[model samples]
Structure formats: structure tokens, C-alpha cells
Target: MTNELELKQWYQLLFGKIDSALLELKDYDGNYYWDSVDPNSLRYFVSNIVGTPWQNHMGLSLLSVTDRKLSPQSIYNLMSTINARLKNLFAAAELSEMVEFNYSVVEKYLTGSLMPDHTDRQRQSFLTAYGSFIFNVSKWITTQFTNEQQSYFSKFLFPKLPFDNRDFSVRTKALDVAKETRKTETSAVTPQLPEIRAESHFRWNQVHRLRKAMRDVLEKARHDRITLPLEFSYDESEYTNERWHFVLWDKESFGRYYKVGTSSENEVFLEFVRAENLDDGRPGDGLWFLEILRLRLIGIWDQEYLEDNERLKIVEYLNQWGYEDAVQGQAPFQIRNPGLLTQSVFIVRNSRKFDKLLINLEPIYVACTFARFALDIITSSGARMNELLQISYDKNCCIVTVDNSVTPPSKNYIYRLIPKGREEEENYYMPEEVYRFMSDIVNLLKESYNSSSIPEVEYSAATRKHLMSKKRYIFQYKGRHINEFTINAIIRFLLHGTIIQTSEGNQVVLKAHLLRHAFATHAVQTEKIPIDIVKSLLHQKDISVTEYYSAPTHQQISDTVG
Candidate 1:
């Protein structure tokens, strides 16, 4: 029913817009053009073929062949129909690949109208052949298209695909297999909460020792016992000209010498100047400094001191002490802290003036204390790092409610946080001990700043925009909001040098988000809390997600059966 010129105009309009959008397209990690083989190529890959589950059987070439057989109007109709339906399913500020398409959407709009008389198996096969075409169109619309383009496509696209009223079966073997696989995979990957709980106690003991040593350094720096440009003499002949050095020492030696100094550029440069062979294994006097210094730097040091190119040099220096790829990996040094350095210190390799140099440890002490308190709160409350960082002091975010109905009065510590995916405020409950700890931290912040109340400032997460109205976050240092990187760095600091292995023999790398998983698992499996209640506590939209967190172990299943 369409004229030849009209069909040509539609093709030109649709392809032109798609090509324009593709020019600026990026993947979830901001890699240009999804890091495709050819950035300008419009080809798409279909990994799932109908009969072949193990190999990709089709690509854009197959779709091109199919297009050649169709009339121009039919091709335009097919493309427009798919685009129109997919636009309706698009969510704002979400990735195209992450959108979960329901069965009804896939069936009614995609495969159903095209093959009404075909069996479910036949329709699935048909979809297998053409699914890439639909996916590529959907990706273009959701990820690349502008609001104006989306509106035009939705409103002025071709007529809807014809639909039938016949009943379709809901249950399928593929769906059942997928559900079972998901459950099994989730259970296998979920860290055992009991192991984490036991390991946490040991880690905290190590942290306490490190904290005491840091305090000692701060006190000595204040009293002028430890002077900067600190030199360690070893034979005094073989002088190394490196400006910065990273020294690795045994854990017990960490408390003996915890010195750190900064440069004139306000950069904290840690070094252990040795004139003797490093393999000689003499007890290096200033050897134990870099371990704690690395942790402190990760937690508080400003990242602007080192350029991207300079990071390579720092990584190279760290590698000299057997810390290969330490800066690039999940170690504390990888974290980027936005907080400003309150005091600057640097190490001179072979400078003659060593006595006159003095580096203040007050900033390091404050940063260490902040990191400790933040970790305590995170472990106790099991809050998402961003949710905790965004807590507003001015908004009365924490509330205490007394339940007098019990034999002795009990108080509930409730905190209001704007959880991810939802804009409305949700209440998170904490223990009395955690509430008291939070109060002490608030007092410490107020006293440190010489103010009656904590300062209010805007805080934003790096990944997504937080929807909270109140911007005054309480977890800030020196007028800067503490970031997720800093919190994770604190975790790495606490667990440094200690290896905790999983059941699968893989080493455990502690992170702030992992603590969240530990919390959910403990609540559901250990505490015996009902799954639905745990779902409410986590503010999850679907019970299925909570189910994954609460999946029982093989041992638990065995015990139940027994």
C-alpha cells in the first residue's frame, strides 16, 4: 500500500539517524563504539543460534541475505515495528544490554505476530534467526538515540504488527533450565558469611595494631623525635638516586618506624634510602614505613599530585619491592581519593640537610581515624557505600525509637537512605552500638572542624546520579565527601598481607560491596530471618534477587534433608 518514493524516504530517514547515533556510541565502561571490531561498521553478532547452543551460527551477513528477499516496504515495516516496541521498553539512564525483556514482550511484539500459526518451537526458531536484527535496533534506540529521535520513532513509525487472540503456553524447558542454573551459580559464588565473620575479627585485631602504630608516629612527629628527609645508612657508599621508594617489611615491624614525608608540591613521598644491597637482608631501620604509608595515602592523599603518566613510574617503584601491578590491581594504591592533603612531606634520597626537616603527621592521623570509623560503621550497618556517604547531617537522617514493650526498654537506630533504583527515602535499622559509634564520629567531626554542626556539601556517586534531595553528607573530611574508593581502600588496608582463601582455593579480596553481600547472607541464612523480611530490609524490588542472596548451601540442604 506504500508508494516507492515514500518507502525510500523512510529508509533514508531511519538509517541516517542510526548512523549518526552510532558515531557517538559507547559501551557501559565508556569504551568507544562498544569496542567493536570495526567502530564504523553496522554489523551485529547473534551468539545464540536455534539448533546450535555451543556456537554462534549467524551474523549481519545472514540478515543482509534475508533483507534482499524482502520488498523495500516489508523491510521498512519490520524494522519500524521492532524499533517502536523496543522504545516502549527502554528505561531512562540504564544500559541497553542490561534491560530485561519479559517473555510477553518478546512473544507479542517480536515473534508472535510474524508467525501466528507456527508452533512455539517454530516461533522460537524464527526468533533465533531474526533476534540479532531486533537486538541491534533496540541497542541503537536505547543507547544512542536522542530524546527527539526516540519521540519521532515512537510516534511516526510504521503501523503495529498484527496480533492474534490464540492462547500461548507459558512454561518452557529452556526457561526452567535457566532458572536452575542461575540459582546454582548464585549459591556457588555467594561467600559464606560465617567465614567472613570469623575472618573479620582477625582483620580487626591487625587493624588495631596498625592504628596504634600510626598514633605513635603522629605523636613522635608532634614532639620532633622523628625528623623528615629521614635517612637510613647502609655502608653509606652505594647511594640510590631514586626520589621515591617503597619498602616491604614483615607485619610485626610495622609499629617500629611509621614515618612519612611530603614534597614541596604537596605530595606525600615515601622512601627508604639504602646504601647497601637490598638482598643483604639486614634489618633496614626505615624499612617498615611504606606499608602503612601506602594505606594512608590511599585513604586520604589527593590524586592530583600524580599525573596519569606518573602513575607508571610509581607502579615501577612499587614493583621493585615485589609489588607487581600493585597500583593497577585492587590494592589500596589503586583508589583515587579526592580529599586534599592537609600537610605536605617528601623524602630526599641523599640530601645533606636531614635534621632541619620536619613533616607533620597530624593529617595522616586524622585520615587514619576517619578511615577506621567509616569501616566500623560500614561493617555494623551493612550499608551500601554510596548510601552511607550520602547521609545528610542537617536532615536528621538518623532517628532513635524506643520499644518499651519488652522487659527492658530497647532502642532502634533507624537511618534514612536513598537506595539505588528508587528515589523515595527508605529507613535502614542499625544496632544501638552502631548508633553510639556514629554519634561519637559526629562529635569528633564537629570538634575537629571547630564547629557546632558538621558542614553540608553536595555529594555524587561516580556510577549513577543519587536522587536524594538533601546534599549535606556527614561522612566528609576537610570539606570533601569520602568516596567509595576510599572506603574500599580502607578495607584493603585492614586486610593487607593476610590471605583468606575461599572454598574454591581463590584468595579473598575484601571490598565494601562484598560486606553488603556478607550482611544479607548472614541475615537470611545465619540469623534465620524470613526471606520476605530480608527483601524489605534490602529494599529490593523483586523477591527473586533476595532469593539469590538467601540461597542455602549444600550443607544446609543436607542437614534439612537429614
Candidate 2:
């Protein structure tokens, strides 16, 4: 059990720490208490992002309130339900009500006031608030039924009371949210600052790997390691193999271009891109300009210049050109090179920026660790970091293994295990990285087939039944990014948090997944493993046509290691 007095002081410290950062937020404002770094500021954020996303989360949030005559009762219900539950939680025994409390939460929703996503600007606070709400609801009910059981004889030990009723309505609300969500950018309702940076970092790391691959190809070509050019051009006879390295383009003005591709019948099909003519703008353009300038750019470049509107303007320019009539004898902008077009557009609104963040090493540590020790017992032993979040260890493995029988199946499909006491991966140790994640969560395994750690409600009967024969790993949440889907998501809450101010007055806590990328990359590097091993470890393979989906063995990584 947590120390009551210490915990209270801790929460007070949390509140005081966040409260000091905001100028507009009153000390007792209810918004600050949730997970967002700065709640007050988040109420107003700059939503300059322009696009028609399939499902616009920010747009729906505004429309959810704007479209409906959502009474204060609706908001009150959101808050009260959250409030009542928080009040009853055992974990927050020392946590008392903050100011305006229920009314503040409900008031915005009740009055149909524009409520941007609290999570955007105030991630931690929003999560804190969201968690507090969930914690309060669950804890209170658990307390009333568990500790104060006799007094609540009116209901069964488990209340069939419609938790799903509210949950279901939230699903419907999303559809309604979709319809009511405005397509156009609105100054009236700005989004909160995006707070999911940790996740964003993980996505960006994949881009880093791709960048590295491009660099390797270019460097090899430059060194005359191959006869071909850096980026092998389809029209190498006419176009030198040209590549765009960042340093070359840093000082040069960059733009987009449109190309006319030939179809089977030689029909012209126009294609648009955020670059100059393929033949004209490769390495030579940037390199040529840099040579003339004779000056290397000083100071740190932002790495992602594409986000700058000056660069992104190329797209919009193309849009305008589509409507432009010949001003003189031809279009206003001339193609410096053959039949190619170039305009300026660097950033695609709502398009993700590839800013690499730190990838936490913990989870990768977990998967590799398990693979190392379990190799002797398994068919072929190599682990992917992904399986950590959604792996389910089969019952047959537990029968002989004997060590991990009582573990609860995951809410998601994450389960993994090896044969009892076997640890040889093609006669080598599995990567050490995965061991760490497993070491942290291995304690939950039980002696019986019955689940001891996981809650059955989180999963469906079909899933649970499957896990009855399998062991499951559970992450707090799971999702996917570019290239591939992430199967397992464990320990999402485990991270160092940072705070940033929002345009409104909210503060948000951001995590470190870019760091995790660094960690995963470094881990493979440390192990002296090959890029393919890294590729397998990261689950980025799409060679799904044959049986390439199966991860390679330790030997593969070992042989490929640089």
C-alpha cells in the first residue's frame, strides 16, 4: 500500500508543480489536476493544420459540442460520473476534490462551449483527468462493493449496471462527432497541442532508418563501391543518378514539381510531388548552388525543413497552376528543365513531421531477454520487440515450462513463451534488449491455467478462450504507425514526462519514443547485429508474399551485424 501522507504530499507537489507554470490558471482550477501539462492554456490552441483526415479527432471534439444543444446536464453527467467514481477510488484515498470540480467539467460540455481535446495541449493533465475519472469511477464502485459491501446489498457483488450503456453512447457519439465535425479550419475552435510525442517519436525513428539506408547507398556510390549512381535513376543514360542530401539543400531554395507520366497507350498521367524536376533537382542542383555560395550553412538545421510553409508552398502553387491560363504564350512559371514543373510547398498540413525522439530501451530489452533464455526450448529462437505487447504464451509451453502457468491472458492478444528450460537460438543467446521488458512483468504468471493478473472484462470471450491455452502480455494500450502495425503495447505509462506550453494556456506531458528508436537501434548495434536483424526486430518487413513474415534467427542478425 502507498503511504497515505506521502501520497497526498506527492499529489500536492504534482498540482503545485503544474500550477506554477500557467499564468491564466487559478490554483484550484479543475483542468490542471488532470494529466495535461498546462490545462488553462489548452483551452485555446492554434489549429493551423489543414486537411481532410478520414476521422478528424479535433474536428469531432468541437462539433460534438457545437452541433448539439448539449445541456449542462450532459457535461455534468460527464463530470459527475467521472467525479463520483474518483471520489470512491481506493488508490486515491487521500485525493480530495479540487475546485469547481464537477461543475467545471460539466459546464463546458453543458453549455456546448467549444472543448478542444484536453489531451492535445494538456496531455498529462488530460490523462490525469481521464485517469482520475476512470479511477474514481472504478475505485468508488469497487470500494462500495468490496470494503463497504454490506451497506450496498441493494445490488449484486458485480453491478450489471450499464457501464457499457455510457461506453456505447460514446461510440455513437463518435459517429455523430464525425458528421458534426466541420471540414474547414475554424478559428472558433482550435486544437490543443498534440501531446502524443512519444508515439510520434517511434514513428519518426522508422524514417531515420530509411534515411540511413539512403545515406549508405549514396556514400557507397560516392566511394565508387558500385558503378551505379547513389539513387539509381531509371533514365540513367539521360539523367545522372541524383540524390538529395540534406546539407546540399539546406541553403538552396527548394520547391515541388509536376510530371507527366506515360501510360500503356502513351497517355499523359500527371503526378505531383514536393520537389523540382527529377532530372534537374537531384544532387547537382543543390550541390551546384552550394559550390557557388562556397559557404557551409552555420548553426543547427531543424532536420525537418519540410514543415516550413515556404517549402510546403509548392503544393498550393501546383493547385493554383491547375487553374492558371497562359499569361503570355505559356504558364507563368517556366520549367527550367525538360517538361518538368517546380513550385514551392514543403509542409503538407496534417502530414506528420519526422522529428526523431528517444526510444525507451525498456520494452526492447524485455523481448530480447525472453528470446535469449527461451531459445533452447523453442523451435527457432529470435524475438521481435512487437510481440511483447500482444504475445500469448500457449498452454502447451506452460505445461512443460512449469514456470508461467498462472499468468493472466492479456486484454489484447499479446502472449509469448518458450518451451520449459530451453534456451538456444541457433546456438546463440537472443538479443539482450527484450529481456528487460519481460523481467518487469514476469511476476504476474500463476501456477494454474486460470488468469491471476488480467481482468477478463477487458477482452472478449473468444479472445479469452484463445488465451486459456496461451499466456498473454499486456501493455496499457496499443496502436500502429508508418510501415507496420505494432502488436504488443505494454508499459505505455512508463516514461519520463516533459511539459510544454500550449497556445491556449495548457501544459502537456510528452514521452520519449524517438528515444526508444535510438535505444532499439543502439541495442542492435551493440549486439553487432545486421540491419536485417534490426529490420526483423522492428517488424518493418512487408515481404509478405512468401514466408518472409517469420523473423530471422540470432544467426541472421549475427551474420548481418556490421
Clashing pairs in 1: 261-345, 261-346, 262-345, 262-346, 263-345, 263-346
Candidate 1 versus the native: TM-score? 0.49
**Model 2: lDDT of residue 182:** 20
Q: Which 10-residue window in model 1 sums to the lowest lDDT?
A: 48-57
| lDDT (Cα atoms) of all candidates against the true structure | 0.47, 0.27
Per-residue C-alpha lDDT of model 1 across residues 327-403, encoded as one tens digit per residue: 65424434344432233323221121232222233344444455555555555556777677766665468787889
Per-candidate RMSD, Å: 15.4, 22.6
> Which parts of model 2 have CA positions greater than 4 angstroms off?
1-108, 111-171, 176-562
Highest-TM-score candidate: 1
Model 2 lDDT-worst window of ten: 291-300
For candidate 2, the TM-score is 0.23
List TM-score per model, in order.
0.49, 0.23
